[model samples]
Target chain A: MLKNYFKLAIKVLGRRKFFTFVSLFGISFTLMILMLITAFLQTELGSDAPMTEKDNLVYLPAISIKRAVKDTVVERDTSYQEGIMIVDSTVTYPERINSHSRSNPSYYFVNKYGRDVVPAKNYSIYNNSSYDFFLNSKKLTFRALLTDERFWEIYDFSFVEGQAYRKTQVDNGEAIVVLTQKACRQYFGQESGVIGKEVVFEGQTYTVSGVIKDPKSFHVYVNAEAYIPYTNLPPAVLGGTGLMDGFEVVYQAHTPADIPKIKKELEHRANLFEEFRDDYATYNRLEMMSYTFRERYADNLYDEDDDPAQNLKTVQWLLIFLLSLFVILPVLNLVNLNISRIMERSSEIGVRKAFGAHSSNILFQFVFENVILTFIGGLIGFILAIGMIKLINESHVLYETTLGFNFKIFFYSFLICLFFGVLSGLLPAYKMSKVHIVNALKQNQR
Target chain B: MISLQNINKVYRTKTIETLALNEINLEVSEGEFLSIMGPSGCGKSTLLNIIGLIDEPSSGNITIANQTVNGYNSKDMAHFRNEKLGFIFQSFHLINDLSVIDNVELPLLYRKSVSASERRRLAEEALLKVGLKNRMSHFPAQLSGGQKQRVAIARAIVGKPNIILADEPTGNLDSAMGNEIMNILLQLNQEEKTTIVMVTHDESMARKTNRLVRLFDGAQVS
Candidate 1:
């Protein structure tokens, strides 16, 4: 029975070429857009590449310092006392002055307060910046991260050539660098054979010790084209007293279960360091917080004035609204088209009913037909989405980022198509199935 | 093989009630070929719909093949219709998307006991009986009015039902094609002893049947 229905459905789709085209256009286009968005979200936010093992890591990305100062204000009362050349009374009150500063945590702040406080298996402190290098009298800028040898252990960089610098090399402040594939091509005009080659940046020459794959563009914390040792940074950059900010920290716990303990310890350290004195000045209050990958991204969405939890909720609601709209609008369009299309076959429905088809059978047939349509449309959308992803990668719209299609994305797209099919097909199928036989038969005469 | 007791079908709207079939009481014997003659909107099709179990009478008790079917649920009615009755419509009512053979196989598709191969064999046999075996793959649009009605007859007999109900089977055909369809009905009645109840307006067609009943304004006259 199902086989017959499937055969009939294919024939019907072919019979009405214009209607089929219109329906397929709406379905395929909607699914393609959704697939593209899903691919982007997966690449940017999903567990892939260097951050694959990020579940057990906590990051301290910023430092917030607040202070309140007391100033004396004097109020005098004079009039009749002035006539006698004497003051009657003088009052002094303390005025409150509040100031707050927030930025990426400095190396000095992380080393002095954050290092011993968090109970973790390992940790790394890194500073992110960009530097200009002269190549044949042409200046090119590349993003760079300066860190210790422990950074390599914490990060899972895929090296294509050679290997990362050793602990001894970092400690001795050796002028060595690790270049990403993109950076290697830019500096040496070749992907391989770049290891052990020297590149000059701002009058300083460094040999490339390794060539690694470029990190995704959205990984702002670790997406550097060039990686060098922190010990090699200039004295001025390393001389920060907490006010100067360029560094961040990542702590790797023995297991993800130890995250709460680490957060608690960091909270205690923040409380203990409430009043901090540095070369810049003294702060009356300080807040040092740790975040998981999701929380870190959410934290970046708002400023210090906005509540992070509330911001996350708002963002979540917005995303749900957008996705629902994306699905609902196309579903509604398909439903309308299907109703009109099915209504044109009322005579067929009447004939089927008269020939022993139950209402449920009719319903099943229509829904099955719709599911088939959606699957076809989904296939077209999948091919189109892959082509779009390739185009985006080739065009470098995301700048060194390459989005990919994976099994997870494919599974999700399949569900979306199924959901779309059922949602759009149900109402029209039910309406047509319940049509009175006499009325349906009469439709042919009109 | 078919019986109806005081069947009443009333169509109601907000401010009007129209009687489509009024107190219709009739019985058809085994292998009896009966024809109903009526004017337009005179309840011929309405009565046929009720008898075929496609429309429910407002107040009636229906019996077919010695079993009371008025109280049967939708599924039971459908199963009973598939097992005991076949239908042919004036417009042929064939699904235009399907081939002629597929249309003939429509009734058997609802029968769970019929395998796909058996259905194809039965459909081919029915088409052979109708003398349209060569046009099995052609769609309804490719066939003439007479050929379309012949395909409808093939579909009606594909399930080998005990009774066949046809509404204006040759209403759209010419005198020659009409005679051809009437001859097919006659042949089926004589050879297979299949009970047939057909609704028509032609006196010549009615005269050829074993029994004739006339209707005027929702009531049977003779």
Candidate 2:
């Protein structure tokens, strides 16, 4: 029964040359679009990232604080009446000093006995500045890491010429630099040549001890092309006297399953700070790796008032919806075409039915034909999608990002083709199978 | 052998009802050559469709080969048709894309009793019997009208059905070609002793059969 149905189906298809071409063309066209969309989504989700241990890595954004000063004067009349003469008065304020008391004061006053007076000089002071001030301060600059050497153990950054900084390097205050491939090319004209060379940054020269691979992870900040010893942060940064006064502490869990416990522990640690206890306490937030992209780049992406995580989630959803639209429309169009073509074979179906073909047999034959056509189309579409992705990657569309060919995308597109082919063929197959032999034959005769 | 007892077939539409077959009773014995003759729209082809188990009677009992088939479902009827009957149509109804041999082997593909190679051999023998052995590799479109009908006749006999049903099998051919096709049918019945039933509007074609049944307004007249 199966053989007869397939034989008849092939014969009927061969007989109607124009209809077969149209139907196959429609299916192939839809498959191409679906394949392209699958490739794009896969690349966006970091499926092409070369690192084998991506899930274990975490990125931390450093935070700091510094005090800033602004001066203002006010004038007031002592006398109640406007016409009354008022005695003139002048006030003096002392200059600011560090809380450590070892740092020099910007201003001071000497009394008649040659002792410094508290209010002799007219200088105003402010204290208890937050992390943002330190980060933006021009007077003090340092590379402040709130983490230790454990960070290197989590991420596998490739070294072209030299090794990663050792734990002792952090402890001994070694001023070493790890240059990314891009940075190496920019500074020394070659990735290997950058090793042992010195590059000047912020009026200081640091030896490029190693050339590291570019960070391919989507979540990492692109600007962190250089690594400095975490423990070597200057005394001014450690004592809250420099631009790096605030420390953005990050710790990685041993595995993804430990993230929740780690997050809870960090929150408990942040609550112990006294400065974060009052109304200002709401500003303190601890997040996991999932939120790092938003937490780190929120300010640069949107207005300070907008929620960064919400924006990213919205964009992700929009992309998914757009991709689905690109896939579903062509699939539906092909499905309609398939149904119409099947309808045109109603007479052939009736003849087959009269010849002892069961509904299952008929359904199988139709589905088999569709699967064959779709499989061929899928192969062509996959090749086309790969070329398209390569072309788009080389173009300026996604600047600074690479779209590598991904097997997962190809497999996903193939699965999509199979699913849609079966789903689209169902209605037509059912309708074709149920064709009444008598009526169909009579209609054909007419 | 075939028998129909008071069969009625009515076609209904939203605004009209037409009876294509009404109160028909007929029987043809095994090994007999029978012909059904009538004007167009007189239900001659409808009667053949019913006898072939391709159409259902609105109200009646049909018995083929001494077995009642009136209440048989589609699957059972299809089995009955494949095993008990073969059909040749006025248009030949050959799948034009397939070579002549493939077209002849179609019915045997539905039957599980024959292997593919055996069926092919049998189809080749049937085509040889129909004098079209040289044309086995040629597609239906590549054959002349009489040759196409001969291929259709070979296909009908390939399954070794007990009864052969031909509906105006020579209507598309010239008189000489028509006579050639009629001679093939007569030879099959006389030599193979297979039961043959045919429908035609041509009286001379009807007269060639061993027995003639005439129908007017869906009922048998003689």
Output the number of the lDDT-best candidate: 1
CAPRI classification of candidate 2: acceptable
TM per candidate? 0.92, 0.77
- What is candidate 2's lDDT per residue for A131-208, written digit by digit as tens? 111212433222222233544554556677787677687667677777778666655667677667886656556677
Which pairs of residues collide in candidate 2?
A64-A131, A64-A246, A65-A134, A65-A246, A66-A134
Q: DockQ for each of the predicted structures, in order?
A: 0.46, 0.28
Please give the lDDT score at residue A375 for candidate 1: 86
Q: Just chain B of model 2: what TM-score?
A: 0.98
RMSD of each: 7.2, 14.1
DockQ of 2: 0.28
Candidate 1's DockQ: 0.46
